[model samples]
Target: MSGFSSWSRRRRRAVIGGGVAIAVITGIGTYVASNDDLRPLKVDFVLGGGDDPTEYGKQLKIQGQFGGLAVAPDNTTYLFVEANDETVMWRRKPSGAIKRIQVAGMNASRATQAAVAPDGSIYLAAEDLWRVSPAGEATRVIERRGCGKANPLVATSISDFCGATVTGVTVDKAGTVYVGDQLIQTPPYGSYVHRLDGKSIELVAGRPAKDGESVRPSNPAVRKGYDPPAGTKAKDVVVPDVTRSGALAATKDGVYWNTGPGIVRINRDGTLSPFVARRSPGKISDPSGPFDTVGRALDAPVRSGTGGEPGDGLAAIPSRDEIYYSDEGTSHRPVLEGDFRWQGVESDAQKKLLDESKTGSLVHRVTDGKLAPVIAGVQAIATSKDSLYVAVTTDIKYRNTPENSATAVLRVQLPEKN
Candidate 1:
């Protein structure tokens, strides 16, 4: 069922959100960074399969490539979801130990971004929206069909029930989760922005659609209120008037996400602004510093077509003028008729087939409308406090070399003026 080719779930309906769970992680190991000369330091963010060359070499056959990542709000830890291990999520602590997090009710789908609330509550945008409890319990705040399924015996949960497709999710200091819903599958090909503020989930942006309704942005408004329909709701309500594909990250300033072609910010006042946009295709434009670029005439920054054409993964830092994100290349074609369809796809033969494919991801910093490469071969990026981290995939081990690729962590210090 894996590697046959495609982004799992696109899921959380990725292509946006990543794996999420509820709870606080324990037994996290800590490592202090060396500030000997204030130059910069790269350290192991987490320790896991990256050590076992054979492990990743084997996994690459089935896993394909790396998935989404997010840093916790505590400025202490971060989380990442692997392609092969779709259901299980890994949390990297300061101690460098990679701990396993079981996201309750999550489907074996591809994941997107993970947002950490100020209170340490983890909001992961995968499939639907999942809020991980401090006790490590995952509760589906919003449910989407194919994103997750609840056990029939687990009497307290809803199943296959979100009314829209979630692409990105970001939470504010107040713990409000704003979802970028792309009515992807539904007609109208519409997009929207939704908010789960306090008492209920409301449609902060985009026209609301009832189940089975097909309409576009130009159509007259049917309903203007944001209310969740009762009884098995994991389906499309309606698409938004925004970009259909994107990811979200939040800062005290506001929530920002990939608005189709460029990066846009949504202020606390519900205004749409542009942040980092491309001047020419794969280049960043100017004039629009980190301030509210909404309504400003900006250029479009298209995702690179080098690797798998991975869109930008965003992380909102405390700084208003800058942000950290992942810029990956969706550069390869997958092998369809291989043993990947088999159960144990890590055999030497399978590994050989996997090695034939080449792809990479990177983490970059965008500030004052400038681009700087922080880490290359980065699968996902997340930032908190004075630290920035990336998941550099080592899937190349299967290709054969004296030093095989080891999945490792890369870090960059703040004041990223580069």
Candidate 2:
């Protein structure tokens, strides 16, 4: 689940004390008051937390770290768990029966993300792409063809090759699969968006760059701003500055991904645009606004020493254009001036601050262009008809114990849309 290179860079500098100021400002009273609307959405623990992974009759216990999670239309839950040095898929049915799914011929441990199609088929992405049918049969749909020494600059198409790293995957209502690929190799070092329809794969946005070429344009033109002339080839009309961090979603309109600039949308016609604007570090402009306004704001220069908040898990609504995403807030970093160092009290404060930042992991809903925070401390999210399923870390400080190890899946009822 952690294949995004940008995420790895952010995790290195993540200090527990990063959210101390926010905690002090909000306090307990203000925090409670602000989240009053979320109180009615009851959070019921569905699974996890025990000494070991076991299934006894209708009850199941899951331990160790987990990756992606998805909920089928029938309310069946699928979870990827890493235990005993192997990755396995666990399926929990509506009747409370739990069983492990054997995804033959593939290393489930390397799966970075998962999505369930409307027909109840599960899609997994990693170095390759796979589909597990509702009847429990798994097939490798896309074979990972290494880039090798091939030159992306002269190559006309990437239909046969998979990206060096697959960070996110999602299935639309029509059963079409969309994949976000981050190619970190030398010749084609950039991000790409690909669509897999049946047996054909097409590059929708971004392109493999030449050596020393920039993939992210400082001022990327969006939609009509940079429309190709008559008869322009799809591969030649590249949309720059597009990137992803393990988050990708699709609606009837198009595909959405979290990038350094914010959430970007690639329309069905291959036109690129901005969905949400990044205002500052850990902040974003209101999602409900004119597209030109958001696009213009995104074209502005990014602030120094800060990459915009990149979303984590993403899930699209079944029959609606709405989407849900998780934001992992920035980690705290300390600046050293001269020889000044932290004292015992300061060290204790840092520890306390780190603990307080756990609440900063937030889930948000994007509906009718409005972005609303739904819950806190969520690591990943998946959606069903009337509920949102989330994987939440029970104890961020320690995961060595049964009570604290691994994340617990919780189901939260969704509020009626306006």
lDDT per model vs. reference: 0.45, 0.50
TM-scores, one per candidate: 0.59, 0.67
**Poorest stretch of ten by lDDT in candidate 1:** 15-24
Model 1 ranges off by over 4 Å: 1-45, 49-68, 82-86, 95-98, 146-162, 207-244, 279-300, 304-312, 328-358, 394-408, 413-418
TM-score of 1: 0.59
Instruction: For candidate 2, give the lDDT of residue 417.
Output: 42
Q: Which residue pairs clash in candidate 2?
A: 16-354, 288-369
Q: Compose the digit string of candidate 2's lDDT tens values, residues 279-305.
A: 333443322211111223333222212
Candidate 1 per-residue C-alpha lDDT over 109-205 given as tens digits, one digit per residue, 9 for 90 to 100: 4446667777766766665667776445667777654333432111222332344566677777676677766555543345566666554565554
